[model samples]
Target chain A: MNDAAGKNTIERAEPGEVGIVQPRDFVSTGEFVFESGQKLPGFTLRYETYGRLNPARDNAILICHALSGDHHSAGIHTLADRKPGWWNNLIGPGKAVDTNHWFVICSNCLGGCQGSTGPSTINPQTGRVFGMTFPFVTIRDMVRAQKRLIDSLGIESLYAVIGGSMGGMQVLQWGIEYPAFVRKLLPMATTARESAQGIGFNEVGRQAIMQDRDWNHGDYPKNGGPRVGLAIARMMAHITYVSDASMDRKFGRKRTAAESSTAAYTFDAQFEVESYLRYQGEAFINRFDANSYLYITRAIDHFDLAEAHGSLEKAFEKIEAETLVVGFTSDWLFPPEQNREIVLALLREGKRASYAEITTDLGHDSFLLESEELYEIVRGFLK
Target chain B: MNDAAGKNTIERAEPGEVGIVQPRDFVSTGEFVFESGQKLPGFTLRYETYGRLNPARDNAILICHALSGDHHSAGIHTLADRKPGWWNNLIGPGKAVDTNHWFVICSNCLGGCQGSTGPSTINPQTGRVFGMTFPFVTIRDMVRAQKRLIDSLGIESLYAVIGGSMGGMQVLQWGIEYPAFVRKLLPMATTARESAQGIGFNEVGRQAIMQDRDWNHGDYPKNGGPRVGLAIARMMAHITYVSDASMDRKFGRKRTAAESSTAAYTFDAQFEVESYLRYQGEAFINRFDANSYLYITRAIDHFDLAEAHGSLEKAFEKIEAETLVVGFTSDWLFPPEQNREIVLALLREGKRASYAEITTDLGHDSFLLESEELYEIVRGFLK
Candidate 1:
């Protein structure tokens, strides 16, 4: 068995579990330049890896995370951990991105609030949180940072770069920025460019956070800023992440018995869906930084491959990755047409690309949900 | 020419303009009991009417306004008015609602803020603004209050009742509450019951307002409560009112040149869509009351015709009007299926009802927009 720092050498205690994995930090002392021409003297990226790289190092795959995801894409942090990593169901020994056969690497994105250099991270020069001082980071900047991490790990070429939503955008950026370096690309539930509706929704969330008095111009102390605003944003964004049908199936007009007294009308979470959303918002504020949300959503809004490259087809012209773009049938946020558009652009450029659509009621978040259909598609694509 | 108070007898210098209509108030000294058994000792409803009431009083058509709408459904208030009343396109002379042929009566909803006895109005008993003290009012309650106004006007409401969105909910209530009073019922872009997704969105808005410190538990002075919160709510809710395709068509990724500087990333509205939404949010706070928004949305959330009447068919069992429920194809908020569901229940109950689906990119607000198809549908249905 390999004893490398990246490899999960620990024996599995449960089926398909990459048990007892640990996150490591990669601090790059070299200057990093952002897409907006802003520069950082140095940066740290927190990452976790599973399985082992073969002698040839051709089995390395990179996993990118969505808006709220992080480096802990698989495996339990500790034995007492209540939940495994976000993508545990699909990223273990025998899972879709089987750790038994491939070396998997996942990192917190460049402007992420998770264990990465972000707005919440302290500026080494000033010894204060970067806050609004953190430079604008785009999907391209995120991929570029990951490229540095990949280079540090001595992986010259990647077997695949896979992700969904914002992560999917980075996967696309990987194929375009380092065409020959990534042999395969799997992006799901994402668009080449965020739609106007997407921008509008993001703006609402941004406004919610910015308008909060506690936000204090993004200078508030840790865990002390815009709790209500961030929660409200999450609650609203949570709705967009789930399908209307799914919500109806899950919550309907079912009132919370505890809150729905016939005595009087009050502005409380009376409906089960309202209660669930409020809970989601509350839970989110505990983990996420409002400034990071503003930064990340801004990145998403600025992601327009077509606009950047003159045309979507032109953007795919240099892509060497064998791309598989998966779209969810009920994902209204980044609908099937948007996913299909990516493949269509690739095909128009004569690139090796295909599209797979999974029918699910999970909406934009279908990629994170456990689905045998999605599993089969991913497994088969990687194979 | 009839010189009755409801008639717009003034000369119309502009084509199709109702021209200089005036708002009037109806005072009800008797106690008004709400659906939840809460009582209002007395109330005043601000209303406006266009066209003359025929001698038989059967030519009067009751027009209902949506959540943010008011009594001024048609005509210019004065020569200096920047814009005519909302729905002016459809409610003017020779238009779809055709003030030339029908007396159209519209009132600010009972719990509404626009010069109506609502949360923003004074409570005679306490000598303070009703604020959160205003009793919970449902679609049925609003309809009941309007019925009193109609009775005081010496009208039996024999012609028709028409509205969209929240107004549509009220229209349905009118048909059910007084089955024999109304002749034709035209409700568009509304649902028999607000879906879980709908409730979730409403909850987000409520949370935004309630979380605002300036809301002061709904006791803030008139024009001074939760501006930021109310604006954020409006901005988000406005997005739901329009479709993705419509937003794409309207704003796309077009960055506002004045704001899109390459110097640095700022939270200021950069994208045209973002700028537009900010404008929407800001404008909304100037006109809407935060507490009124809470009460109305709660009323909408509580509107469950099926559950309230045991079943949807049971709810439609007493409908004596020839009803036509129009659904907009792009309205994701209250999709065509939801609108069709109402007609389906009516059909199951063997009632005179039909469904019309207007293919448009306007989304839920398609009913309010200028569309020949919708106009034709409304005109033909009313005829």
Candidate 2:
């Protein structure tokens, strides 16, 4: 493995293995101002890079992650890890993203929990965790931060920018905010703006967290957050990630293996789906910060690209990048019709935009799954 | 209006108005045993009737309420009331369910909160609220309880039984368990059994309520239950009640009037849909009992007609009633395909069953709404 000198270098993995890449922190000296008039004195972006940046720096690609995603996008953090990164399926040496040819960078977005400066991070001014005091972040604010990171890397422009769901919102924002800097854009399973149903679901999740007494109005003691409320929030969200068909196929009407044929009729997880959701919720609580979930989901709910630019057509008018917008048939959260709206707007602006509605039972999360069709589409578009 | 003598008279409305039919309680002398082996010493069923039962007593039509419904199926309880009943549009004098032609009965289900012996009711054994101690109720048990009430009214082999959602489950159970009693069955916007997605959503809502510290393990002080948790649960359930199309048409991305163009980015109801849901949740907390909500939803989750009888076809084998199953096109909670499953099973048993898939954007709640097509179908079927 090639080790280039940087701020700090951690252990390297074996050659040919898209293994652990240590994340490095980039602290901005200037204040990070949010659209809401709130500002952070200074902020740090935790990011990881894969592959080598060519001398020309023209091979760089930026990967924006969805809600709850971190900087770890292509490899395991350690050799003992049972699974690699969230997008490891498509972002390896010979994978769809093909890190062998593309120098990929993935950063924990602003107001995220994994490593980026977020609600869980310490406020430089107060010497305490920002908590709810952290200024609410918008997708545009996140893109702006990423722009700073890219500029610092000496990469004038990115070969391509890719993401799905909330990450896709960032990708769209990038195209509008820095049209000349992004060569191509791949925004999958996202809308130009959050829909009413989408906002409603997010609001319920927020309410679930805020209602938790342990949440303490977003000022829970350090490492002591609203686990139960956050778990409930995750459970609610997990249901939306997959389609009804997928749930039926995966769990169906089957009861938990431990549950007897005779109904217990108790408030236990009797159905297999219920058990699965509980497991998912519990697992999420271990990794995600409750306050971060609140901020990020709010960011997503408030995302309306067209609202900022006056109209969708106006939002696309300045987009100079070639775009490939993908949507899944079963994605109720970000339905294919909503994705189509984005492409239609791009087409109306006479921009180089193509649309693909993939038939997948995986729902909105199909963008992160291993699908040959999705792979081919991404490969063709990027090529 | 005709004054029917009962133990108590509440109020009366203007002449020619099907208004203010006071609910009468029928206390079963024997123990009410649940499918889970738990029992209530004696239970009361609060019921309201519209129109007069003829000499033959065969003109009675039973209307089962959905999850949040009560005995108030038609007309206002008092003159000051701005609204009539939940199904007022369809149950008035010359309406589809036509009170002028049929003697209609609507009862609060066995586990319902509104004027029924549910978890909120006092337990004879402990002299305290049943709370979580309430016996687990099933759709079959609810139908059985209704049978006792109908028998008390001297109604044998009633004209018809109709319901939607949980109420529809009761209608199905009535046809299967008391085949000889129900002359016709009208089950709308329901399934033969709860689907995995349905169970998942219900489980999440249950978890939301149970996780609240204020829940006090389902034994919160009188009128001091988990309001926030219950409200969250209501908000979640409300999402499933309507279609994405309906939400978009009703609220879309429109923000609340108070929210400024520039995002305030606060943890408040920014979107109109969010405000609407918050209102729905708050309003529900005023009328619903948390523990009752738990018990009733569990009853709905446990409802599987086919599971009781080896197969769905077997469930319909002994049914003597002419069945008409109606499903809304946009009901993802209980899709048209699920309703068709019931009709298919009935047909497979050589039962006289018809199916109507109404095209509506109202989703699962369409059964309760005023639809011309639905009215025509109900009218023709009852005729």
Candidate 3:
């Protein structure tokens, strides 16, 4: 069925049948004030849900997506679709997240462009799109927006809040901001605060986008965005998502046979890895907004639970949820040490906390990838 | 004295005085052919020499440079100049690469723009800048050009061939291509060949430059080249050059005082690291040519000494030099394992080989940074 926004609603199928959910908008009546002292007047949050909410409404698990991810957390949108949802590997009926048991809620984050009220959203004050005028959003602001969605759904508390990367930031934010409302927390492949090196990388990506002439100071024409800049940004970022070992295993120095039988040695995409990265960049430009990328990444870079709450131990003092902090061994972006910091903080707070460092060459993306180890840990924790 | 091309010759100072040498151009009369089936009619290689050649003419040590480096490896250009040569910290009198004991030769690599025939150099036949027309030059090609320079200097063999990163690649090439000419080889923070991850990074940089509209297919106006693209590329490369631990120590999450006394939650460079990277990018744009960057990075990406010589074991077969492979613990770009690979191969060939894995947080740039351990190693090995 179609919602008022013309977006498709969740399709319920047989217990074992894999099903897709379409994003639906929840328009808030009041203004949402941001940490930057800016406000959005009656913004809309786009979200999707799978499975059925139990009569008690306490079986709801909120799934937070990472950077460049959205409400599509599981299943395929259409039969012809080449790819399933971003976390389809983890959130399927029989997968780690197990939508069959818990009512799953996945929302496009605030400051995101995928059907959410973000930079491309039309400003109520002005007749044009918000462009760069959109208020800056922090992880807390995103969680607050998500909280509003949960409140509207009549869920007093979530069964679990699970996420990786920026999503994991939200999980930590939930633990701090609305501790009582999150019964269980699984923050994977993330840190309490963004590291200097991580910030440096994000800054470079933002600079690449901002420097493009076509960006037009973040007010590019509707159909004409900063493709080159965005592509370059994506190419740079894509490198950080996977480890060196993973790249070696996947693409290596294997040359694209069509480009040059030998070494054409021109600036062409000669290596298979280069070709893969180029494709990622081009594909990213098609799906993502440059301004949204800028805003979301800024939010991530600004994240610091310890800074906000005075200290790491102090940040978890109010947390009532049973937390499971997970990290990927190869995740250089948010190393396991950073995840251990959170676990240690939680332990110091005298809260029930557990940690697992999943060894994988998959890097930061290991949280979403299908692995028996991750699945067992997630299933055991959720149970 | 002024050369025929108006380039200044190296100035001879008093015996004990540490003095900077001016770059002198060595014009090759015959055509210079590239590995990519492209040819240069003739090329002028710009190089700097410090200290005097001994009576035996075998005290010569050729110093190869990494990406973005040039002929000025040590000493200050002028007495009033604030900055000494890039490696002045390690290449002065009584330093790791002592000028007092050795005649040091540093040259702008074959595809370099600094006082050398490169993409920015005018193509005689076309009466235009070579731009993208410059033939692809490999690590072997760079070493070959150095060979010509050495022959012209009447040097029968070099006392040592020393370099790090791309320069290290050149050192390996020298061991295979001109085994008898290089008596000792020190290849630091480098691999026998470029890794998939390394190639991927270089490709991203090249894409960033090529995608810029101002690049104009690598034929941009002399004064109006792709500054933004070049800056972004430099920023990306800079991140790889320094370690995560180093960045944390240097910049941390410390916010820039101007952007926000606290976190403004804005997209602006709130972090000091961002400011540092921006400065690096801007400063790099002032000194480097975009086309030269493209060509040089390509040469690095295409470097595969083992592949050229059939295998790693075979590559070291002709190496007559006593080799020392140096690696920095924190260098993820060219990790210690890669350095160990070379040492292992040399040992397999029954050659005089030693390896030193320097404990440093300086990353790939550790070779240029001050370290007493490295100093002792170099001093002992050279002696």
Docking class of 3: high
TM-score of predicted chain B versus true chain B for each candidate: 0.97, 0.96, 0.95
Please tell me which predicted candidate would have the highest lDDT against the true structure.
1
lDDT of 2 by residue, B178-274 (tens): 8898889999999988888888999899998998888988888877889988999999999999988999999988878888565577788878999
Query: For candidate 2, what is the lDDT?
Result: 0.86
lDDT per residue (tens digit) for residues A282-366 in model 3:
9999999999999999999889888888999998999999999999999999999999999999999899998999989899888
Sort the predicted structures by lDDT, highest score first: 1, 2, 3
Lowest summed lDDT across 10 adjacent residues in model 2 chain B is found at B1-10
Error of 3 at A113 (Å): 0.7
Each prediction's whole-model lDDT (CA): 0.90, 0.86, 0.86
Query: Model 3: how far is A121 from its true place, Å?
Result: 0.5
| Residue-level lDDT tens digits of model 2 in A1-383 | 12351212224645545776677777787888888888877788898888777777888889999997988887777778898788988887777888778888899999998878999998868888989888889899999998888888878899999999998999999999999999999999999999889989999988888888899888888657788889888999999999888998998888877886655877888889999999999999889999999899888988887888899999888999999999999999999999999999999999999999899888888999989999899999989
DockQ of each: 0.83, 0.80, 0.81
| Over 4 Å off, model 2 | A1-17, B1-17, B261-263
User: Could you say which candidate leads in DockQ?
Assistant: 1
Model 2 pairs whose backbones collide: none
Better of 1 and 2 by DockQ: 1
Clashing pairs in 1: none
Cα displacement (Å) at residue A377, model 2 = 0.6
